[model samples]
Target chain A: MNAYWQCLRGIVLREWLRFVLQRTRFLSALVRPLLWLVVFAAGFRAALGISVIEPYDTYIPYEVYIIPGLACMILLFNGMQGSLAMVYDREMGSMRVLLTSPLPRTFLLCSKLLATALISLLQVYGFLAIAWVYGVQPPAMGLLLALPALLLVALMLSALGLLLSNGIRQLENFAGVMNFVIFPLFFLSSALYPLWKMRDASQWLYWLCAVNPFTHAVELVRFALYERLAGLALAICLGLTVLFTLLAVLTFNPQHAALRKPG
Target chain B: MNALTVQDLSFAYGPCQALCEVGFSLAPGRFAALLGPNGAGKSTLIALLTRLYHLQRGEIHVGGHSLRDAPRAALKQLGVVFQQSTLDLELSVEQNLRYHAALHGLSRRHTDLRVEAELARQGLSERRREKVRALNGGHRRRVEIARALLHEPRLLLLDEASVGLDPASRLGLNQHVRQLCREHDLSVLWTTHLLDEVHADDALMILHQGRLVASGQVDALVQEHDGDLGRLFAGLTRPTATGAPA
Candidate 1:
């Protein structure tokens, strides 16, 4: 167990170092969320009316409403970005160094997921600090409780990214998956607008948002930030994380020649 | 026990077979050469041995552990220097070595001492603080070799690690690797297409079209074909009067 922790610590430290060195990446991760919160939310503030939701006893501003979503957005993007790096590393042959360690491949992949999740957590916290500076802050205690929620969401998203990294052979295919999967997953979620707003737009879209695992991930963070436990959100996020992580492991198994072989 | 054994190794990428019934073995202090042309499955075989790709119909044992059921154990005794560089250019030499040591679960104090010893042994002691990007090709390859040995693995695999180096550097690196095998009693499987890279006394395996066309000591194998390894290699790898280059 000590050795395992040491390995995990090294992996996480390497990831943190990598995150710090890549200035453009860290800044861009922050920039995208700020755009959604400051620009998109500003534009849609008057357009979408807020109602009393379960966590909300009174009306909330559009900026406050999208804070969790922005945080989720950072995690979602960083998770995929981390997976993208994994695919690039595999192509470049660095991943072989990581995978060929004597440790179980599952544990190695888990370490990568955890490392990515921790970085995503950092970016989320950075986004939250910026959001606070912009005058939209969660309850101080709620912010503390939200750490676990952020971790859960980060795990789910990173697992999804890992699944994609194992599934896609080439980096070129990643763009298509991002456009087809990530964008739709984000827009269909209640990240930017409320489900009620989507309901008015179309019942089908509202249903899609409700079913989207990303929606649950964002809602999981949002509810936790209000010092509330979202049972449904927790269930879906945990379930998807386990399912995706298992799929990633299966895809990465050495015997899975079909998956590893170049197309 | 033999340090490494590969029996009837076969693997394919979809419809195209990359390795077909290839077999070889290396005793505990032997240096073996896997010579093949591009697309002759040398890389594929290395991949299989390193557990990057699994065998479809074959067996590979490192030390005594089978790659299939006991990969973790098998891999623990194996180290590889791949064709492409794997060093993190952002890291210093010591940092890179320490990171790999940690991955193998070495204690911090021991890892630090071992890293220093390895660096000194590899002649990189003075450059330990230099970032990987600051090092030249030969120095970088040395760093990789040093890192691979950090765990004191019994078997070492080198896949075209000397490519793109000056002739002097290439020969120097090869000599260093060969000396390491002799001094440390380490088994080595070095894959290269360069005919000159194979020593006359080294065991040689020729791979062509994903099959082992020949295998034996270099002198004997070449002696069978009129003491000409280059002609024999060319004959094995060249397209047979084809319409165009394969």
Candidate 2:
């Protein structure tokens, strides 16, 4: 019993404490979405128009359309940021200490991912509260429904981040990942604009948005804000979470070259 | 029972071999030193012993548990201080130890008591609350040593842990580790490039170019070379004109 709680307590506290130690990291997580909410959304409000979507009964402002995206942006960056911390820990040798423990490596890694997901959830709520101050408020009951959706998105994103961290060899290579993964993932999804708007530009972009797992993630949050359920979003997000988590575990397997320290 | 054993352990990186046909074993409570120069594969061997890498050819066992078949159990019986500092500089000494203890699943009540006992055992109680960044190099090493012992492992492996320390600190650390082996009946495998660090009774293995050329008690090996361990080490490791197959 002590062992079970310790595993949960240890990794959770360690991950949270690491983020707390760097207050700037948390601020940056909040600030990035805030920038999108304030400057980018303000500038692009007129350029992009919105039709009444399924989740929105009446016509809604563009600021409201992108709020879900900004919430997702927080989860995306913060989740990957946690993975980056793992790489730093590996290079600094503290990862070796953690890896040598008696606990199964899978459990240890999962514990970390769960902690990261929880932190991402907190950041999403913080961003939502800030967005409310800007006159973009979800139904008060909608906020309650958003919790489970936010958790699912965070889990999926954090798993993807862990998988990438396990594969990347050097710190220098991580920048390329941000551009290839975060940039494309955020841009190709329904984060910035709805899929129908992308179809107006190109069928290919719309198809990309249709297949993107992130599209489902944003859709999940968007509908939750209006007290609606996204069955497709739930399936896609949960499926991707399991897929990415399996990849992470395989990559960290003792047989893998990248996971091992050179003798 | 042997505390640790390795049989024909071999590994390679792409085309370059890192370890080839390496083998050794240490009895319970014995102290052994793996002596080699830079790029001689001493660090590589330590990595293998710690199960940081899986070998293509060979077997490693700790207290009778196979590394390949039971890594978590094997690792639980072994402790390691790597060549690089593993301490979290942003955390205090006690925080670092507590984090490790929790990972090993020690209860909060036990972790506190064990942390105090370990700090006292490592002669670090006075500095327990100090941030790791504030500690000097030697003190940081001490923190790592105390951390490796927090779980009370039967085998301890140190990879070039004394490098860059002042002479007095190095001697102090060596003495302290040797004392731990005696007091706790822990088997120790210490890797170092410095010949002076090898004691007369300690078993020594000379490795060069990924091959083990010599293994025996230091005093016996020195006697075989007429009381010249350095010359023997060089002659065995230096490439000969014939370049005989290792």
Candidate 3:
């Protein structure tokens, strides 16, 4: 019990230290979403009219409306980037240090997932902090309320990212896969445009947005940031997080033949 | 009791067999050297021993715990230094050791004491705060050794751990590990293709193409195979599929 706690603490601490050491990662993480908030949102502010949504009491600016989605975007990119690092670790032999732990592989992998998720959350909050100064303030209480919701989405995306990266045979292909997964998950979901806008664009596209777990993740954060509850979104995020974690743990073995993670 | 044991062990990567019917045991305090050429499945065997790859057939027991049936317990009693360096170059030596200790579930007090002790033992206490990337290859390997020993496993396995070291560093590392084995009563299975690393009295196992071709005391095997270590190794591990011409 105490061992589990220590292990988790250590894993998180290592990740935090690494995150600190790599200043460029944090900077890029912020720069991506802030680009959307400052530039993309300004460009779309007049073009896309956001109606009264459940979390928003009145009409909201594009910048205000897309904050949750962009927050989730940070998670999405971090999740994939974390997976790429996992593959890199495997090849470079650092992963041997991890798998050799006497702890159950499942527990170790989860510790890693939680560690990456926490680090991603730091970047998300950083983005939110900048957004607050950018005149896109939610309630102070709502900001506090969004932490747990954002954490769930982070875990879900990290787990899903790990599961997806397991199939990647070469590290060189990681960028391609990242662009492939990130673009679809970002654009097809309610991250940029609202679901109503998607429906207006195409019925099938709207269905894809509705069913995409990222949409529910975005909605969950969107609601939590306003001190409300999206029950269905919460349920979906919780369920998918568990599912992705289990699937990731199950398929986590190093492939003996291809050494998918290594050369 | 034997510190480590394997029986009828076999593994395959698709159609290519990595190990076959290979069985051996390490006595509680002996230093055993495993010799194999590049294509000789040494890495595969090490991967299986460290639980990096799942077993397709056979059994492995580490300090009486079956690796397949009880991996956690089995791993708890085993420590390994892989062929490739596993330390995070970005982390300080002390930080790397702490991470390993935590993975093994050591308490804070235990971790501090163990880290200090192992670093001192490895002559690395002064470099605890130095990032691993700043250290030379030999020093980094020592850090890995200290980390591997922190949990105090009964057996230590090194898979070609001295690959890139200079001749002096390689011999120094080898001698250091032997001294550690004697002082600590820890069993070791050191794998390498270098014949000079094998002492006449140490337990020796030469693997060839997934098979244990010869295993016994090096002196006795030397006596049996015409008193020449090089010829014995070459004769036994000829590239032919049949092996040894026996």
Candidate 4:
């Protein structure tokens, strides 16, 4: 309906405005991946030569191989940060205004997830634009094809973030959890090294990387960026997006966050 | 028809009961004040009424729609201003109002019209483009009021809306809301701990220890307990000789 469209527009517009106003957030989002591409990848290029994979047509340097993973890294961090803001909103009273809407709670939450995903996409592109100038270019059409793949990963991660935030009692405790989640998700996956590389390191470590949803998310982007279809990865990302979003909606208890602790 | 109704509503946080057997109703276009001291379960009752917490034991109807069975319809007819300010401080007044209107599913034209009308009604038209952070506490509260009314719900529920205001600002805000009730025929249930905010002619309800201790017209309840409002409140809500809530 027109009403839902208007609501979606308003939510997205608010996020866009906030994103524009907070210059530091955008810069910080860029800094993390840029460091990996410019510094980490440069340092490791001689040590890790990437073979031609299913998505890559030829041998590539470490920087080119990690570009897709780093793009997803932006989504991963932004997604969790978006949920952190949700916790902050609940504490600060703005969430009460949001929850009182006449729309179904499920719809409101979905709109929020989609809006945050949309914003994450913008940040991903910003990182990609900088990477483009740094000689990490993919095929022009492949960049366009990667749009939906990136969006799906964004939604999946943001939904996971929201679900995680539901159980977090306070903002002070969030940084510890973030480091716990982000490091393992980034390091254990194919972000820095391929699954085969992990297999050479340890079988259990390789299995962990194989099963990580973040790994599939990275592969989804990696394949799409080369104009290849990652059917299995696409299915897994879609399934987890639905599953996490449902759980997030079901477990969301605004009262628990909004109530004052008894003194 | 009553604009709002609650029957035997009860809620608990784990083992601790926050509200019990709470019941009340408000006729359309009337102003009723809910008064209670701190720790007296006012916030809990508001949370239940606003559907922030699920109904654990009983029923609530807003504008003839049951909250449990038909929440969307019920919520559509109800507006709430929570104890904490819910405005987005980084947003301009107009932007905040527009977001609320959109959440209520208003068309752009309708949102513009209602935004204009409510801004004028709250005397906030000149400050429409000002960021909420720039406004004083009193003005921010008015912006929330305007936002709550944009959808034109029949019932307006405010929980401790006058807290932290200057004495003059509090009085002015209270009077402004009362004027809204009279002019717009809107039903209002305002919660506050301040006794002076309740007029003798207005409907009054006192809550204590998660129970509704007394409820009726203010002057009548005062006369029934004693001639003094303060004594009546103290006697009803204070601990008894046996260490139970009076």
Residue A214 CA error for candidate 1 (Å)? 1.4
Residue B199 lDDT, candidate 2, scale 0-100:
93
The residue-by-residue lDDT of candidate 3 on B165-204, one tens digit each, is 9999999999999999999999999999999999998999
Docking class of 4: medium
Per-residue CA lDDT of candidate 4, range B46-133, in tens? 8777787788998999999999999989999998888889898888999999999989889999999999999999999999999999
Per-residue accuracy of model 2 over B158-235 as CA lDDT, tens digit each? 999998899998998899899999999999999998988889999898888788888999999999987898898888
Higher-scoring candidate on DockQ, 1 or 4: 4
**Against the hidden reference, what TM-scores do the models get?**
0.94, 0.95, 0.97, 0.97
Which CAPRI quality tier does the interface of model 2 achieve?
A: medium
Q: Tens digits of per-residue lDDT for model 2 on A1-263? A: 67857968877887777778888887888999899889998898888878888899888788999999889989999878877877777766677777777787888888888999998887889889999999999999999999999998998999999898887776777897799899989999999998998998999989998998889999999999889999989888989999999899877754342234454
lDDT of 1 by residue, A46-65 (tens): 88767778587789888888
Candidate 1: lDDT of B240? Answer: 57
DockQ scores for all predicted structures: 0.50, 0.57, 0.63, 0.60
Candidate No. with top DockQ:
3
In candidate 3, what are the lDDT values of residues A29-137, reduced to their tens digit? 9999999999999999889999997878899889999999999999999999988888888778787788888888789889999999999999999999999999999
Clashing pairs counted in every model: 0, 1, 0, 0
True contacts kept of each: 0.49, 0.66, 0.69, 0.54
Q: For candidate 2, what is the total of clashing residue pairs?
A: 1
| Candidate 4 residue spans exceeding 4 A from truth | A260-263, B241-243
